[model samples]
Target: MNAVAGAVQALLVIGGAPLLTGLMRQVRARLEGRAGAGIAQPWRDLRKQFLHKETVRPRGTSEVFRIAPLVLVATSLVVAVVVPFVTTGSAIPPAADLFAVVALLTLGTVALALAGLDTGTAFGGMGASREMTIVALVEPTLLVAIFALSVRVGSTNLSSIVSSTVHDPSRVISPASLLAAVALVVVIIAETGRLPVDNPSTHLELTMVHEAMILEYAGPDLALVELASAMRLSVFLGLLANLFLPWGVATSPDPLSLLIGTGAIVLKVGLLGVALAVGEVFLAKLRLFRVPELLAGSFLLSLLAVASSFFLA
Candidate 1:
């Protein structure tokens, strides 16, 4: 039953990811006073990409380049299944360890970086270098933030943390919780290639981070990469929503409860998408050099959260 429930939730996340991406694009377009593509546009785009007859592999690229997208999407699906998207209880409880979740995400990033380097293109190398630098900074802060929350629950398991916080909302009000939330929000924006870190909509060669790595990909490869990117974004946003505001997640295995939990997560993630769009509209991307500073600030916040958790406990 746990495996069944997890499979269902993973399917929901993978299927709905492109919709979330489309919705965010539409919201951003409207905010900028332009007519937006329909919320189904990402799905249309993916279909179009898939319909293309061939994928052009760049010269000197290896099997790693061809397989990176699959690795990325697979790792994200694993995260979706283990992250308690619609329930406080996990299908695979041991997989819900916060460190394991972070490691899986890091593995995906590392695979992409290797793929980028495999292309031997200047843009690819540059993007991969920048990405690795960012990840190196982001991962520790991410772990520290999770550590802050875990301290309160006495376990690093995501389901355990969510259950503890949900059962006692007072934990949500603590200094550590607030600090960790802020740090995680910063990490999310950076990790997801959102504005003030990296812009998802731009292909400007000089400014592109994520886009640069995928410039050589086309057709089915591009579709898979794009879908993986969307799913990754959705997973991060869903984690943020359910972890911080776990109000509507199911604690039981009943059908009705799972149905309600599904609806609640969709609403939560949708509202978060809207908020992100609005925030992006008001903020400009930080300078490439300045990005390290911003991440450093997040690291400081995470460290403070850890300190607060220990001292205030």
Candidate 2:
């Protein structure tokens, strides 16, 4: 039953990720007073990329460039199956440790960074360098922020963390939890290349981060990379939702529970995506030099969360 729940959870994320992206775009469009493309636009884009476009391999690129998309999507799929999105129990219990999950995400980041360098383009190299710097800060904050939660729960497994929260709702409002939540939100924004840290829509040579890295990709390869990006957004949103607001996640693998769990997660992540889009409307990307300061602030919050967890207990 745990395996069945994991399969359903994975399908939910893969199928809904594109829709989530489209929804966010539509929300931003509405707020910007434009009649936006419908929520199916991303799906249409992906279909066109996969079926009508030809894969282009740039000159002087290596296998890393060719394989990075696969690696990124593969790791996301693994996390989707192992993490507690719909169910508190995972198909692979041992693999759901918080450190393991964080490591998987970092591995995907490294693969994409290496692929960017493999392209040998000036923009690709610049983006890769910038991305690694962000990763160095973001990853540690992610670990420490979640570590604050684990300190109280007494386990590093994501399932255990969620389950503990589910059974003890009060923990959600604790000083440590609130601090960790803020820290994690910043980490997600930075890691996902959202506004104030990086702009997903921008292609300006001097400011683009994630886009510059993928500028050399086209056709099927581009589709995979885009799909993986959407998946990662959904995965991060799901983690944020489940880790902090895990009320509706299934503690058992019964059919009814699984159904509720699916709906709950979808609703939670959808709301988060909309909120993020709306928030981005008012935010301009921060200067490149100031990004480190923003990330440093998040790191400080995480440290406070950890300290509060120990001292306040």
Candidate 3:
């Protein structure tokens, strides 16, 4: 039953990621008074790239450049399967440790950063350097923020933390929970290349962070990179939703519960994506040097959350 739930969760995340990206764009467009390319545009774009474009290898690039996409996608898939999006029980329970999950995500980021460096392009190396800087701050905040939640539950297994939340809903309203939520929100925005951290839509060399690394990729490789990115955004949003709002997630692996959990996660993640898009409309990208300040602030919030959780317990 856990396996089935994991499979369903992976399918939903993989299949719905593109739609989620499109929905955010559509929301942004409407807010800006534009008709926008429809909600299916990302899907269409992915399909067209996959079917019509040829994968191109840059001259002098190493095997890291060739295999980075696979590594990114694989790590995302592992995270999707292990995370308790649809159910409290992970298919691979042993691998569902919060540290393990964070490491898997970091691995994907490292893979892309290494690939970026391997390209030997100035933009790629710059992006990789900037990405690593962000990662250094983001990862600790992520762990500590989640640690704030795990403090109450006495375990760092994501399933355990979430399951505990399910049983004691009042914990969600605690000061620790609130602080951690805010901290996680910041890290998620940073981790996913959202506004105020890095602009996903911009290709200008000065502003490029995530986009610069992939400028050397084309066709199928680009498609894979894009797909992995969409998946990462969905994964982060899903993690955010489930961590703070674990109400609709399944406590048992029953069929009806699993179905409800699936729907609940989709709704929660969609609402988060929409909220992020709306917020982005008003936010300008932070200057490259100032990005660390925002992340540092989030890290401070996470620390406060941890302190509050322990002291107030």
Writing each residue's lDDT as its tens digit, candidate 1 over 159-242 gives: 999999889988888999999999999999999899999999898989999998999989898899999999888888898887
lDDT order of candidates, top first: 2, 3, 1
* lDDT, model 2, position 90: 89
lDDT of 3 by residue, 179-251 (tens): 9999999999999999999988887998889998899999988999999999999999999888889988988
How do the residues 122-206 of candidate 2 rate in per-residue lDDT, one tens digit apiece? 9999999999999999999999999999998899999999999999999999999999999999999999999999999887999
What TM-score should be assigned to candidate 3?
A: 0.99
The parts of candidate 2 lying over 4 Å away from their true place are: none
Lowest lDDT block of 10, candidate 2? 247-256
The models' CA-based lDDT, in order, is 0.91, 0.94, 0.94
The clash numbers for all candidates, in the given order, read 0, 0, 0
Candidate 1: Cα lDDT at 19? 95
Cα RMSDs, all models: 0.9, 0.7, 0.7
C-alpha lDDT (0 to 100) for residue 137 of candidate 1: 96
Local error of candidate 3 at 198, Å?
0.9
Using Cα atoms with residue i matched to residue i, what is each candidate's TM-score against the true structure?
Answer: 0.98, 0.99, 0.99
- Native-to-model Cα distance after best TM-score fit, residue 252 in candidate 2, in Å: 1.9
Residue 150 Cα positional deviation in candidate 1, in Å, after optimal superposition = 0.6
